[model samples]
Target: MIRRLAAFARPFSAWLAASAALRVLHLALGIAILTVAARALAAGADAVATAGTIVVLAAAKGTAHYGEQYLGHRVAFTVLARLRTDFFDALARQAPGVLHRHRSGDLAARATADVNRVEVFYAHTIAPALAAVVVALGSAGYLAAAAHPALAVISLAGAAVSGLAVPLLGRRPVRQAARRRQETRGLIAAHVADTVGGLRDLALLGAAGRWERRLGALEERAAGDTRALAARLAIRRAANTAVLAATVSAVAVAGACLWRDGQLDRQSWWAAIAVTLAMAPALTAVEAFAGESGTTVAAARRIFEIIDVPRPRVPPPPAPAPPGPSGSAPPRPAPPARAATTGPATTTGPTIIGPTIIGPTVIGPTVTGAASPAAAERRAAAVSARGVGFAYPGSPPVLAGVDLDLPPGSTTAVLGATGSGKSSLGYLLAAVLTPTHGTITLDGADLRDLPEDLIRRRVALADQRPFVFSDTIAGNLRLADPGADEDLLWHVLETVDLAEAVRALPGRLRTRLAEHGADLSGGELQRLSLAQALLRRPALLICDEVTGQLDAATEARLLDRLRRDSAGRTTVWITHRPATLRAVDQVVVLDAGRVTTPAGPRLSRAGAARPGLSPAGSPGPASLGDTPGPRGPAG
Candidate 1:
């Protein structure tokens, strides 16, 4: 895992090398100052000369120290920024599917707090560890040449004990404590997010006290982990101090014995002591950073866990077959001519793929000429599911062997009670969740084979509970269409019947919403989410109980608008409400993860029934007034 993290710093290798070199230079200067002063004192050299030499070395040491700090932090912050980008990109590749399996607060903690913790490894650990090794060895070798070989042996032993053995021995317990603390922190963040997001509901249900107690328990666990980590760190510090004191005293006593035995001169004795003391700073630094390693390693593991999850790689669409192996491209066939009255209108402005619908409300718009290739594909995207099946990990299957077809420009209603897989089916059709069995297709091409951007652009799903960022109303709506003007924003809002309510606000489009749109009522929040989705003008719009929060009158109005403006668009309404089926052209019932057609009059296209549409069961022209659903009748 440490090796993997080092790869992220590859782009900043030059900075790292410079930082490490400066650090080594700084420590070397400190050792030089000590050696110079010790030898001068033993020889009774000129005071002026010794002081001058020491002062110059100290000045140089300070400069190197500054440079090392600057470069170390530069590399750390830059690498951190890159890590965040890569983390988000990885999450996006596996999104909706992967997102469902993780807590939002835990994900947020990994991205923010966990990533921040890894900064210690880059800023303090790497270069200091490198410099410590270089300085320790240099000091030992110099002592051997300038003093007795026995003195060098004694110095090396002390350096090794203080720098290597003590640190390595204590690392395991420190790391275990750090890991526990990090996990507890993630849980606390998750609980806080859940509590805050559902605070209104909790208050209404009088569960706030229960939530508070749970939070208190998590805080207690986090506090316990923190205390354990602090205790281990305190013990390690005491051990390092003890080792340092013992090593210095042993070196001094050994040098004194050598001098007394006439095996060392006074100058040689002082030089040996100076070199031995020089090893202290480097070895002590190694010990200090070792304590920090436990926390850094734990945080890094958390970050990599998310990045390493398996994500589907959607290949780019195949190039246009290499121009058919000719010098010039082959002549393209012209589209078939249609009756003048039946032909769709053309526009010089932006090509609208289909009518814009928010939730179950629609804002009318028609396609135009000079369309991009992607736009042309979106104009008539037919979808089909063949024996689709899905199940969450460690849970029973949510959907199974379901077959359904949504013809271009058609509206279908999927009616099922809670836990009947209506939302799961919608997710599969919208390409947010991949089917574990069989296939789902868009325009005869398998959805799994298509690029993510193409799927996102052509299909839009207005979730029953959509996320709203803490931003102005216009800002939230602009997420779907950043270039949408005030006129367009108001138009979509009006279509969803949210314009009047918004206008009554003090800031109107500029009004800032609380996190999760906490300030707004449920119906307003849903309409705002719907308006945002409508800005995409997708060919296929999937609404998963988007109108569930609205009253019957508002739901009726929204559905009426959807029926009027949903021309030339494929719409799927996922709801348990039977009255909502009035605006749909056909209805399919999902029960126990299976799709079966109900015995009712179904709307027919051009007064004709589609054959071979199995899994949809018997086809018929359903009367608009009939109340059809899973409990109404069986095929």
Candidate 2:
């Protein structure tokens, strides 16, 4: 982690070097000014000249101070920006999977507050330490040059005691307090965010007071830890100040003794004492940094923890083979190869090579002749899962030995009681989660071997509780299709039966929504989410309880339009709704973590009377096994 942090400073190395140099210049000028003043007072030689020299040194010191501050801050902010970008990139790679293990507020704290703390390491710690070393060595050299080697040794020893020993004495206690403070801060932030997001629910449940108590407890712990850390720091500071004063006094006394022994003249003795006094401020700066090093190091460790999360193993793109001797038929474009050899499964297709929008133009090939466009569209993705299983780390499996197939253009409904892995199955089928025990394939290509972009373009999932950003309607829809025109947006809205509602709004597509669609009715949010998904026109659409908020009439009408709009697309409807199941070609029923009815129920798209039940309007076992369903290992 230390080496990685040093790398961030590399980009601003020039600025950092200049800042350190200016700091050294500023200290050197102060020492020179003191020496000149002492010489003029002790010898009464050229007072006017001495005064002029002091004025020049003072001005130069002021200029160096300004330059040091400017360059130091420039380097600090640059390194900070780099750290933030790199940390976020690392977090993004682990998102939705590894991030689930962390608290949102804790992660937020790491990103903002923890990262900000690292500024102390670069801006206050490194360059200041370097300047202190330079000033200390220069001060000792000047004393030795003035025939006071013994005093020089004394000065160096004093610096070591103040800068090194004082910090070491307080290290353990300071570190402990800092770590506790950081943890408590994260806890409080997480609690506050959770409370705000669920304030209404907490009030309705009459549990807001309990949450308030919990928050107060966390804040109090943080305050107590901070106070303890401050008290320790204050004691350390007092000890360092006493040590500095004693060292200065020792230098003056040692110089007087040397002068009495005829080893130094009056002017030389005074100059030596002045240099030691100047060295005090330099050593004090080092002591100040040492006092805070414990907190800075603690913060650095937290930042590294996020950066070191193991990224998902995405295989590199395959390397192209070398060309044969000169004139061979310009090698035919190689077939879409699988991911790198490290991949567990082979994939084949027209590998998407660049930023290509996913729409009708990029979907898989369509079957011609008798099939309608809708049927052809559904055939674009032939997804299958073979003996698949999933489990969170250290927990029992949530899904086990599940086998399923979603032929192109087919509508499949997955049914299960609460906590029966229905949503897990949907996530797996949509390529959001990788299977721990088996393979899931899209068009005969392992889902793992497919690039993230291709999977996002080809498959769309409407979450159970969809997120609606606070933006204009057009802005929200643009997330699905960035290049979509107003016409295209209206077309999708109409398809989802939401065009009328949006048109009635004061600003139409320009209407802004509150966070999470707080400004819209629950049903309107659902339709809006459906509209966004339809805009993608993905090859496979996984709707996870998308219609749970809709009335039966709206749900039926939306499902009918979905059937028509997604003609050639594969639709996986995860629901327990009887009305929704009747329109699909097949159903998968899960219990616990296993698929209890693997074959599931089959319904004729043209003849089903009830949505999810049997012809007699009852959810009977006969409806589940009436016909053989798609059942086999994933291709």
Q: Pick the candidate with the highest lDDT.
A: 1
Task: For each of the candidates, give the backbone clash count.
Answer: 5, 12
Pairs of residues clashing in candidate 1? 601-621, 601-622, 602-621, 602-622, 603-622
Per-residue lDDT tens digits for candidate 2, residues 288-307, read 87777767777777877878
lDDT string, candidate 1, 398-477, tens digits: 88666666778666777655566877888888887777777889989999888889988788888877889999999999
What lDDT is reached at residue 134 by model 1? 85
lDDT for residue 248 in candidate 1, whole number 0-100? 71
Query: In model 1, what lDDT does residue 522 have?
Result: 84
What's the TM-score of each model vs. the native? 0.80, 0.80
lDDT of 2 at 122: 77
The segments of candidate 2 whose C-alpha lies over 4 angstroms from its true place after superposition are: 45-51, 97-100, 312-379, 408-410, 442-451, 582-585, 598-635
Candidate 1, residue 87: the lDDT equals: 84
